[model samples]
Target: MKINFKNYIASIFITVLMVSIFSSCTETKEEVTLLFVGSFTDKKTGEGIHVYEFDTETGKSTLKHTIDSITNTSFQRLSPNGEYLYSVVDSQKKYNGKVAAFKVDVPNKKIDLLNIQDCGGLNPAHLAIDSSGNYLVNSNYSDGSLSLFKINNDGSLSENSQVLQFKDSSIIKSRQRASHMHSANFSPDNNYVFAHDLGADKIRGFELVKKQGKVSLENPKEIKTKPGSGPRHFAFHPNGRFGYLVNELSGKIDAYTYSNGNLGFIEDYLTYQQKQHIYRTADIHISPDGKFLYASNRGPEEDTIVIFSVDENSGKLQLVGHQSTYGEHPRNFGIDPSGNFLLVANMYTNTIVVFKRDIVSGKLTKLPFDISVKNPSSIQMKTY
Candidate 1:
């Protein structure tokens, strides 16, 4: 065979060029992180859900798309795999709330609604999907119920299979006179689900039992919070050894040591410095590294996010610092997957503020640019 050395050399060069191009493309895709914000919708200035492209390098976010038809999307979450999105229609009317699922396409900036289902209770405030993405737990605020739904293969939600209603009340007459479940969170192991009840002042736990393809919550346990603490949101440390609950009415955070399916109380810390007539501590989240915990406190007095350094070995917290949200009503906030930024959804101010986070100090500094979205209610971020 006659060898063509020139042709062979050219072919090798082309092969190397193709390999470099493919590697670049893959890195670009992996670097993308999307910010999904759910907002309260009204007839006039309604933006139901907005998605943004978060630039990890610059710490800036640009609005990518908006879905305006879904009304009152107060809370939204992405599936464990980042292939689906779920949001809640936070209704005030009785039995009129819903949970909707969508197929998320980040590169194309599209979110197609898969299906909507009745929440089986009033005012679906929060929803969380299990690690397997096979089960969804929705907490209804007005009626104080937790509804369980199974996720279909295509990411749509099945009708709620079970609804657990709570009729207990707490010491506060006006706020705790009736049951008001605020949020539902899954355990780090996905073997249990916990619901925070604001009105009843209790953290309710249920063993998640999955048989074949169906799922149910069994072995319900009620752990009483402070009499008037009004537990609203719960977050577990990444180590799975500790958990924290933000008390809405009393402006306190309860720390607990978690083991198996039980929570042993550690202590409680005040979320704010001064006492006030009303305290609306809203959201709680731990850093990806589990070194710090951030909790939001809404205004009647001050709008701030309190930062605490975690004692990794002891599962205790030391107050690190506080950052003003730079807007009113810091209802919910999210820390990026890289732990480099924190975004706050100030519902009353109708803006989303991005803050550069100091991983060492667990402090937040306001970024120069912020997003304007009407009634921004919830903040969720996913890396795709």
Candidate 2:
């Protein structure tokens, strides 16, 4: 046998080359940049919706741009893929009340209007994408109705195949006068849509039915809260076993068990208490890690955030601690994709306050970062 050192060196180089090529091909892609969106429509000035951009790393956000012609851009939603952004406005159109879509330019960090769709009802406040992303769920606040629309690839919204109006009185009439769908959020599976109706005083659940390129709602169910609770914003547990709903009028959080997108009995419903004064709750979110739940309390002039520990097994909540947001009226906030920071949207005070999470206890300490905007209502992030 002739031993050739030169050939051995060449073989080693070829093997190294192949390994490098395979590694490069198999490397996972970096997460997309996170885009923060907030809508603002000034009442007195007849202004339009304001959109902003934020650097997820540094907790820095700037007013990237604005989209005009929106009378009241109250809530905005990002497509499941993060390619398109949708909003609800106060429209006086012929048939459709008010809903519009915008193409999200992920690279330039800009937004452009796509098309407006008739909401079929008035005061459209919440929009969500079906699990298949083939349909858009619209929650009309004033009419207490929910609409489902077929979404096109270009980000345009078509008419919904079905619409449901809820008119139930759940143990409370003063608060549940008629019916008011305050917010709508989807479960992890996207098969179920939960609409939080303040006036109706119930969390309405609708099942998503898919056929080819179209989608509709089915398998309706209702979860009633305490009389006068006024459920507004809702969130689900990470493991899909629990759900949390924030009560607007009573300043309480209702924790429940969810199976197949339907909510069961309330395991533990507690109110946010700061010292002796009871605080009214605004927005609530569960930590991405599924260990903690953070709820925002706006006390007219004073505001604070309460944190709770989630029992991984029973899906119960244990009060952790409360922290001040250093702002007023925190209507909405977004937990960063990394779960390291939370940016609170203070509407009355006009600023997005940032906070760092204590990993062990889930308590939030205000960070020295604040993104300013005019009348920021909803905040969302897109990691592209």
Candidate 3:
């Protein structure tokens, strides 16, 4: 019959304004960071590396991709430029354990396999890339050796540049029967490499020498830990003067003053106050901002993350608090690039739990959401 022309005009104007506002908001939204989770694959359990899109603002994660061909990608490291990712395949078969390189395609959220090289030892567990991105180092647990690889210009790995095996064993009869190198990392200056040997109870240092574009290890030095300590992982503070060595057997953290790649002992801090239960310490990490340190431990009945506040001036750690992982056997954990969230990969429970971090207090509060993956051993993040 009759139409109200004024009302119709007002409705059209409101729709146009709302669309413009929505478009502007969408255009200004921040991009999501990509998180890559490595896991142990098997015949009975689902396996592969999982890619997740993480929202920094809301601390939410969504699975984006999965790569299943490689088994036992238990540990991974990203190149400094974020253009390539390297992972160690932990296996017991002789010379079967390998290190693999993958070219990262960030825009499409895919990784192209570049090359896989034998790690020159058995059961390669951890790997690290040098600051120049020219060399890769790996620690072999079963054979107690360290292997070095040169990086080609295109990010593929060259043949093993060097491999050094250890013969010494500590006093522990069962766990330290032979030297087992658990973790390897480059010094802040990239002039030295530190390999933490669990069975030897020592953090061994080797000079990284480059001559005429070829790299070699020399001038071996050893930093002894407590008897049967079983140092598993190492982390350097952002200040480059302090180093943290987490002992897997004793459940203790050793603070060291690092100068010119030499580590001088500072003090020992216990991860757990109560000593009644057996402690199985797993991983250690420092926050990006260098304000806090976190260590994961899997006890007989409980899995927890211990937090500590870093004293910037003195390079000392003060116990802050602890948070239960709500899962079993937290093998590894990672801090987001922003240091706002922490993700723990509980191996036995097969879950990755997210926790919101309180930067000011150096505390972790569990988030409601948890990611389910089979035998998740490591969690690493890369920002887009």
Candidate 4:
């Protein structure tokens, strides 16, 4: 058939218009939504967990849902695909040691209870999922044990995949006398798991030996800190070039040179606390861009957030300065996934304070607004 030139041009334009419209529809995927999981059941009322919705762009939030799946759910993290969320229910039910997984239907704002797995450690304080979402690591503060669970494709966790026990004694005999696994983190390659044992005063490393989807421990070793240096939380650089582990007891952040999932001592430790001070530090987080680091000092002498500049060349942290949290006992704080805002969980004050980030300067300015929570221990952000 003979085609007219004018019609040919019109047809091409029409096709281009349709393609642009389809692309416009694809823009919906750009907006990232966040989930804030904080259990409101404190020493008083048992109101279950409060999951809130957060907007990265507008810095706005709304109450999403309250889940009563477990008692005292504290820490939460999403799978790589953002499909499921795993939480640690820090229970005082006498060795209850429970962890729960929830299947999230993001767009619909829905969650289905998946299953609960025994943490294998007492009072699982913090939980972290490997990059591949294959293993979930828990830090049992009371039990002083590290438990790792493999996540099946069905969102159900595998049966007690592995557990590593720690041994030691420190200043707090009754509290930190034995083993207190404060935090568990995985290397980017997911080949090694590093756990901070507060009571042990050491950072323990283990090889996540994988066989047929079951994980076994290999090459277990401990990096000793100063006596009574209660190692707490740590963060990995974005480029996977370096790792920073923070010691809450000693108030120091140790930088390391990590390679192929193995960490080499940079042989340098950066102190974030003042002399002769004890504040029971909480959480540490690296910026999304991995250019900076932030560590929180929990209580006692002036609650503040210590900021540091990350040297990309050496993976060492240079102290930036401390910012007044404007609240009490900042146990947990989170840098938004977008690297724009920071929200601190002031435990005793029952407030979540906000800060505006200076992307250029890498400093935080206090914002007037804050949210109230019963006892927010740790904070995490997940977007879909």
Model 4 accuracy (lDDT, Cα): 0.77
List residue ranges in candidate 1 displaced over 4 A. 1-30, 43-45
- Which runs of model 3 end up more than 4 angstroms from their true locations? 1-30, 43-46
lDDT (10s digit) by residue, model 1, range 252-320:
999999988899999999888678799999999999999999999998888999999999999889998
Worst 10 residues of 1 by lDDT: 38-47
1-384, model 2: which lDDT tens digit per residue? 998999999999999999999999999976545545555665322445555565666666676666655676767778878888887777322234567888888666777888887787877777877656677888887777888788887888876667788776555555567898878877877778888989877888877777786567778887778878888888888898888889987778888888877687665455556332444688888888999999888876458788899998888888887778788888788787778888888888887788888778898877776876777778777777
Clashes of 1: 0
* Candidate 3: tens digits of C-alpha lDDT, residues 91-169: 5445548898999888788788899998999888898898889899998999899999999999999989899999989
How well does candidate 1 match the true structure in TM-score terms? 0.93
What lDDT does each candidate get? Answer: 0.90, 0.76, 0.88, 0.77
28, model 4: CA deviation in Å?
Answer: 3.8
RMSD in Å for all candidates: 2.5, 3.9, 6.1, 3.2
Candidate 4 per-residue lDDT over residues 153-248, each given as its tens digit: 888887777777767787766557788888878888778888888887778888888778457767988777777678888888998888887877
- Strongest candidate by lDDT: 1
Model 4: residues >4 Å from true position, as ranges?
Answer: 1-27, 43-45, 171-175, 267-273
